[model samples]
Target chain A: MTWEIFNAIGTIAFAISGAIVALEEEYDILGVYVLGMVTAFGGGAIRNLLIGVPVSALWDQGLLFLMAILVITVVFLFPLRALKQWKRWGTFTDAIGLSTFAILGALYAAEMNHPLSATIIAALLTGSGGGMLRDVLAGRKPVVLREDIYGLWAMLAGLLIGVGAVNQTWGLYVLFVAIVILRMMTVHYKWRLPHRTIKQQEDVSV
Target chain B: MTWEIFNAIGTIAFAISGAIVALEEEYDILGVYVLGMVTAFGGGAIRNLLIGVPVSALWDQGLLFLMAILVITVVFLFPLRALKQWKRWGTFTDAIGLSTFAILGALYAAEMNHPLSATIIAALLTGSGGGMLRDVLAGRKPVVLREDIYGLWAMLAGLLIGVGAVNQTWGLYVLFVAIVILRMMTVHYKWRLPHRTIKQQEDVSV
Candidate 1:
């Protein structure tokens, strides 16, 4: 099914991205695999929990697990210099993964009769949760919380689906494409959410 | 009834600890409250997911939310200098929270007929998951992953409970107390998990 294909693509994409981050962070082999697996599955796990899906169900995705492992292994086996374009590849795949997963998460929640808020939350988590976990484990701030308008697009996609504005299969595909394009555009333009920072002196007093 | 009481204690303790960390990190008021709530409930949310509990069930604990908020507010109201002993207080409360939550998580998973692996995972996550999340949100490595003998006691407690070596109310209480004492002793003695670090030079080739 199309859904299965999208899921596989997202999983492979996230696993490779995670492996890259681990390598960049100079993590050992075990750490690399752990980060890769977490990045590939952490989002869906978080979303499942939010939408009342049994976390045990995660273990049922044997093929997906295998796919992620394969991707991670490939990433590790390749020389970093040979993958000089890893950054570009990572961004492209990340955009695809995020879009596909966001739509999938929203549809799953909506199908389960979750409310708009829950659906939106599910989409956001599914789209960015794994990457956030990967960054945290790498001892960095979660880019989703601080960087470009990332999670918002996922939430918007979820909102559209939850509101029944895009329920058909073709409609879902269109939405996915739109999301990916939007994400790419945002990154291209360096779009960011508004931020607030208290002065260091004032912050210390409080 | 006792379980509810223990849960409250854990919640309060974690909320306070989270608030303190947020303060130390110089995060804003919003970040402080967010971290506090995450620390108090994130673990249970994770454990529930793993054990097949509906995450929406998290919303059912209105009293817990109120308690966390109250604690965060109180923590913020106190002057930082006045709370100079916060590190000591935080460690003591964290130990209590960790032990109680670990036991509770293991018990919940065991009662659900989960396997030993799931039970132990639940226990570890319940005990340290929130703290890990808080640290990540604060942009620090998880203390549970890096510091002394923290998660081991939780795993041991879970292992005991999972194997039915300790199941009765009295047995559970004993296990909880033992974990707390062991944790405190480890901290006092500066005990740590055996660590291995590959040289940066060696890590790059792989």
Candidate 2:
């Protein structure tokens, strides 16, 4: 029950986020839908692929797909001024989505008896993977890899779950809320990971 | 038997192409290996995920993994002058890889009794998926979507197989050679698809 609720929230938030990005990129209607779907499901698809789940199983979530599409379509049709305001709300919802997805992923991996490392990886990928794909498809740097302290919070959630500190239902909810707060605080504070770039003469062509 | 041969050729070429791109992006040694592995295996992984194969089945190809890693290591260690020379040859090898991987994907889908459209999609994804992933991870536009006549040839190969025009082993061999030639010719001639971009005042930030 908790899992289903979390999944629905994450899916809707991600769908809206994806639609926003697609519109920002000036993608057509079809591109908007495709990008929206990718953002909503890309993380779970990648997590399933890595965790030995049948990727086609994603199709089983018929209601989730409908809900996500509805959210995306609504976002796409909203007026420009409304969208601008929604962007402010978007960060909070995005934090909610990220936290729920990460904890859920770690929970799934832990239930499957995967090692702590695998659980951590699952959490990180599930939390950030959709956003990463969204950014990449939009032709931008993956925010998780280079930007703020985003992935670290996901890792921390995974670690807590893996170490058996958050095995209860209320514990998961507590972790979820804590992570959302941490992510939003980091965003507000503009927290960033340590940066490094190798300075060298480089060919920019691929 | 034929599939194994084609897989080997494709893996080596893609590994080299991936290493070249990673080096061009100025990534460290670890990035080169990760990108190389992703370039070599990402297509098959994506295809398998879409077509209901167990994604983890990719791990069964231990020999192929070793071969891909070895090729990447060699490319990394090559002197700058030698690397430049390899770039000239890289196009030809890449064409070969694309042709082989595309045909193999189509064959797999066809043998499974999938629809013609699915077969074509499989071929296109298998041929171009790795390169797309590499480019995205390196923070560039997917070359397959924007650049050349790359995906068309894969679709063509898939169409021929789907329609039963290339069922025989010899027919497949002929088709492979024809695709390689066509792809190389297009690269030589610089063919491009029709494109239109919507001009608008758009938010570039995602």
Candidate 3:
């Protein structure tokens, strides 16, 4: 039950985020819908693939699909004035989505007997894969690769779960809440990961 | 025997293309190898997922992985003066890779008794999927979405194979050759699909 609720929330949150990006990119109605759906489901699909789940398993989630579509439609119909606050709210909602998905992905992999590395990879991909696809299709760099401490939290969640530190249902809930809070704090504090630059003759510039 | 040969050729071609793009993007050596491997194997991995093949199947292709890595190393080690010729021969090599992969993907899907649409999707994805992933990772727009008549040929190959018009080994070879020629001609002649533009207030410009 917790999984279902968190998954639904994540789906809606991601769909809205994707729609916002599509509109910003000047995509037409078709593009908007495509991007929205991809964002909502891309992460799960990728996670499933990584863990050996059949891609056709995605078709079984009728309710999640409906929820995502409904959310996308409502986002598109929302007033432009109300959307001015999206910058503030978007980060919060995205954090919620990322945390929920990360936990879910880690739990799923742990249940499937995947190793610790695979579980962590599943968490990171499930948390950020859709957003990366959204950015790529919109012709932008993926934020996770260069942004604040985003994927790291997902990895942490996966590690905790894989190590059996958070096994029960209540423990999962706690982990989920903790991750959301951590993600929000990271964003609010503007935490960033260290980056390295190569010092060489920059010849090819795309 | 044919499948092995075609698959190897496609892998080398795509790895080279991806390495070139990474070089052009000014990525480090690590980035070049990552992009090359993703380009060489990403599509097949995706196709396998869609057809219910275990993702672990990817790890089984040790020879292919070695081949792709070797190709990427060679591409990077090639002389700077000779690298200029990449712009000249890259298109031809990419066309060949695209055609071979498209046919191979379609044939794999059809053999699995997938629906016609799935076969077509598999073909298109297998042919262009790696390149799309490479471009996305490199932080650029996927060329298949905007390039001249690229994905259409893959779809055509899938359609023919799915419909049983190209069933025999000889027929498959003919179809593969035909697709390569068509792709080359489209590139040489600069054929492009008509694009529609939406008139809207550009809000989010990446």
What is the DockQ (computed on Cα atoms) for candidate 2?
0.13
TM-score of chain B of each: 0.95, 0.95, 0.95
Per-residue lDDT of model 3, residues A1-206, tens digit only: 98999999888888888887776665555456557877888888888777877775665676787788788877777777666567767777788789888988898899999999989999999999988888888897788887888899999999999899999989988888898898888877888788998776677556
Every candidate's DockQ is 0.14, 0.13, 0.14
Off by over 4 Å in 2: A196-206, B1-45, B54-140, B143-206
lDDT of every model, 2 decimals: 0.82, 0.83, 0.82
Over the stretch B43-128, how does candidate 2's per-residue lDDT look in tens digits?
88888886788778999999999999999999999989988887558888889889988998899888878777667767877898
- Tens-digit lDDT track for model 1 on B1-206? 76888899998999999998999899999989999999999988877777777768999999999989998999999986867888778888999899989999999988988677667767877998899889888888767755678888888888999999998888877887898889889888987654433233321211
Against the true structure, what is model 1's DockQ? 0.14
Q: State chain A's TM-score for model 3.
A: 0.95
Show pairs that collide, candidate 3. Answer: none
Tens digits of lDDT, candidate 2, A14-100: 888777777666665545655677788888887887787777567567678778878877876776777766646778888888998
Instruction: Give the per-residue Cα lDDT of candidate 1 at B179.
Output: 89
Off by over 4 Å in 1: A1-53, A59-132, A141-206, B199-206
Model 3 segments more than 4 A misplaced: A1-44, A47-52, A58-132, A141-206, B199-206
Q: Candidate 1's residue-wise lDDT over A131-186, tens digit each?
A: 98888887877878877788999999999998999998889889988998998888
Candidate 3 Cα lDDT to native: 0.82
